[model samples]
Target: MVAENSTPHLHSAVEPRQTFRRALDMAARAAMPSLFVMFCAILLSAPFGIPGQAQLQFGIAMCTVWFWAYSRPRSMPALAVFLCGLVVEIFSFGPPGTVLLSLLVIYGVAHHWRYGLSRLGFIAGWLIFSIFAVLASFFQWALVCLHAVALLSPAPGLFQAALTIGIYPSLTALFVWGRRTFANPDQA
Candidate 1:
């Protein structure tokens, strides 16, 4: 009762290779967010020694996580966020968990609003990020102060939030390009 020219056998023979390809594609997709965080960590560790570089480094790092979480929650998993935190601890010479905690807060906020934000467009997204950045940065400042047993100056943290909010549009475009270039066709 089957058609003689049916290509079901051809598809069956190709299934294993297709399955392997899909596995690799999924892996690469997962890696893209981690790759961005790793790159930021490298920047944090680099001896550029520029003033306020730490602020810039952490800002970009947190924004990278938030960006992916907001845009593609599946790509920025909790495990990857944790690894990014570990990377920040190793690279930034800060008390452990400082950067990680701040990033987690950002990820949580972004993920929570991901569905609504995706439809709301850039201004609204940027506005929401502004408020969240301030709160998250303040929390990070308090933690660092508590860990050091002295009230730390919060200027750097404030600067970081400002810089992140300022640069998000450009960075979002770059992240979009990255996803387009590296993401699997199915996801695209």
Candidate 2:
């Protein structure tokens, strides 16, 4: 009788541990996308001596937002997207709200097309993202020009868009690996 009673207590103790572990896993999965984007934003902001570093960072940030928003809208909610954009804007020396607005627009488009993008091939997704990169670059350039009250050269913006489109496949592969490794297997 004592053995039977002790068995129940042991099982109960293990149950709570399992429950806690499951909850922790779910929370980590839920937070991963936003956390990853913020990490990228901070990491890319580091002062590398490469030419066009700011443009490269901004392009990478855009790619991060697009991937998360399209692939896992639930994980990367609008509020998190806003916060990520704010982080990017704070890190970069661009005009206020430029990166934020661009990211928000990207998030909106990605979220809206999430299902379609998910069903489409990688090439189709890349083409769509390329269009977004160009539009975001143009939008940011327009905002900067308006802020400065003078027309700025469009060269940097064009370069940023091209760089972003060029790096999509590589960043996407990293994101896919992260999703497979860290996210719930069923979810991935």
Candidate 3:
């Protein structure tokens, strides 16, 4: 009788620990993408002294957002995306709402087409991302112009779009590795 009573108490104790562990795991999994993107934003925003550093930073950040939003929308909800964009905007020191609006647009579009993009080949996905990059660049350019109340050259935006499209493959590979290594296999 004592053994049976102790067994129930032991089981109950272990059960709560397991439940707590699972909850912690789930929360970590959910926050990983947002944390990863924010880290990238901070790292990329560093003063590299490169000729087109801002554009390069923006390109990589956009790619990071696109990969997470397209591949695992649940991991990167809209609010998380907004926060990431805000971080990028603050770090990049661009006009307020430029990067934020562009990233939100990318997230919304990628989330909308995620199922189809998942079904397609990597090349097809790249092609679609190219379109998104250009569109986002244009959108950002328009926003900046509106903010300035004067027309601005489109060259920077175009170059940023090209850089973003060019860098997609490398960033996507890193993201895939991260997802495979850290994310739950069932979720992947």
- Residue-level lDDT of model 3, residues 72-114, one tens digit each, is 8877889998998888888887777878888888888888899
Q: Model 1, residue 62: what's the lDDT?
A: 75
Which clashing pairs does model 3 show?
A: none
Better of 2 and 3 by lDDT: 2
- Looking at model 2, how many pairs of residues clash? 0
Q: TM-score rank, highest first? A: 2, 1, 3
**TM-score-superior candidate, 2 or 3:** 2
Strongest candidate by lDDT: 2
lDDT of 1 by residue, 1-188 (tens): 45766646755664545577777777877687787778778776888878767776677777788888888888888888888878877888665677888888888888888888889877888788888778877887887899889988999778877987887888888887876777534452
User: Each candidate: RMSD to true structure?
Assistant: 4.1, 6.3, 6.1
Leading candidate by TM-score: 2
Pairing residues by index, what is the TM-score of model 1?
0.81
- Give candidate 2 misplaced runs (Cα > 4 Å): 1-18, 185-188
Taken over the whole model, the C-alpha lDDT of each candidate is 0.78, 0.83, 0.81
TM-score, each model? 0.81, 0.82, 0.79
